[model samples]
Target: MCLLLIAWKVHPTCPLIVAANRDEFYRRPTKPIHRWDDGSGIVGGRDLTSGGTWLGVTASGRFAAVTNVRDGKAEGTPPQSRGALPTGFLDSTATPQAYAAAADGDDFAGFNLLASDLDELFWVSNRFDGAGVAVEPGIHGLSNAQLDTPWPKVTAGKAALAAAVSEDSGAPDADVESYFELLHSTDPAPRADLPNTGVGVRREKQLSPLFVRTRFYGTRASTVLRVRSDGSFDLTERTFNSRRQTGETRIEETS
Candidate 1:
């Protein structure tokens, strides 16, 4: 996932809510979110080429998601795929901190990972030094740089998410459609506000929007995952094909 907005332990009834968009090349092969028939008990979209997932959740209440760091100066492909980072955590019984510490950051390209066991949440980034730090209970944002980096999109997204959560809090059911509407925003940041991530200005401009749409590369999926107080969760993913919504998959499981 490229853009992630999270509201953790903020609502009265829900404890965790995540809204994310996964951006990738249009030619990349991917499978829409679904349960792993391999008995992994994991539900997420699969990167068919790499055989790993961007974000996923388990019936046991474990959740994980990862986003690649945008660094054009970094040369040489990393030895491992960053997708494995999240799947590794979801498939393990270890606590978030321990799992993050054991991960060999040098083995993979720059990445930011979020892991949770429904008890606590942690954020780890291979691009920086230090172990995974516990994520505070509040609304947070993440993009290509770092957690809560205040990129234009991140800032706007966090505010939009907070408003959405506020409107849905205490309600009988979450307004899942509203969350998707937020992610569907195609408005681009002003040129003066765009960040220089080493990608050329043209490319950077193309990626400045909350929902990216380019000729070859753009947001491929938008996902919303909500975990209620009872441990029951809802996950919905919408896949896109050249800016057109192609399919959607939703999974809701009771505790």
Candidate 2:
């Protein structure tokens, strides 16, 4: 996932709300959200190129998401894929802090990661010399730069998510579409607001919106996940191309 907006322990009846867009090349092979047949109890889209996931949640209420940091110097592939961060977390029994603390940040390119279990949320990043820090309750955002770095899209997403969660009823399906609408924005941030991430000005503007569109690469998926106070949850994932939505998957758990 390239942009992540999370509302943690903020809403009255909702404990967690996630709205994110996974920006990637159009030709990369990716499987939509699904239950892992490996019995890891993980449900998420798989990056077929790397055999890992960008975002996911386990049956035990563990959640994780990962985003790559935008650094021209770190453009080439590293020793490992960052997708393994979230997949590895869901596939293990370790707590968020423990998993983040033990992760070998140097093993991969610059990346930002979020890990959470039933109790708390944690964030770690190698680019900013980050460490495992427990996140407090409220809205938080992450993009290609760093966690809560206030990139235009990150700020917009964070506000939209907070509003959607605050206005929606407590039902599992309520406001799901609203969250998607929030993620579907295409407006680019103004020039002054765009972050100079080594990518040129034109390229930066192209990638500034909540959703991005380019011929070779863009946002391939927009996903919204809501986990209620009782542990019941719902996740909706929409797959896209350069033009329109190709498919959508909705998974719900009442328990």
Give one digit per residue, the lDDT tens place, for model 2 in 30-89: 999999899888999999999999999876788999998896664656899999999999
Off by over 4 Å in 2: none
Clashing pairs in 1: none
What is residue 112's positional error in candidate 2, in angstroms? Answer: 0.5
Q: How accurate is candidate 2 locally (lDDT)?
A: 0.89
| lDDT score of residue 105 within candidate 2 | 83
Best by lDDT: 2
RMSD of candidates 1 onward, in order: 1.3, 1.1
Candidate 2 to truth, TM: 0.97
Per-residue alpha-carbon lDDT of candidate 1 for residues 90-122, written as tens digits (9 for 90 to 100) = 888999889877888889888999998878999
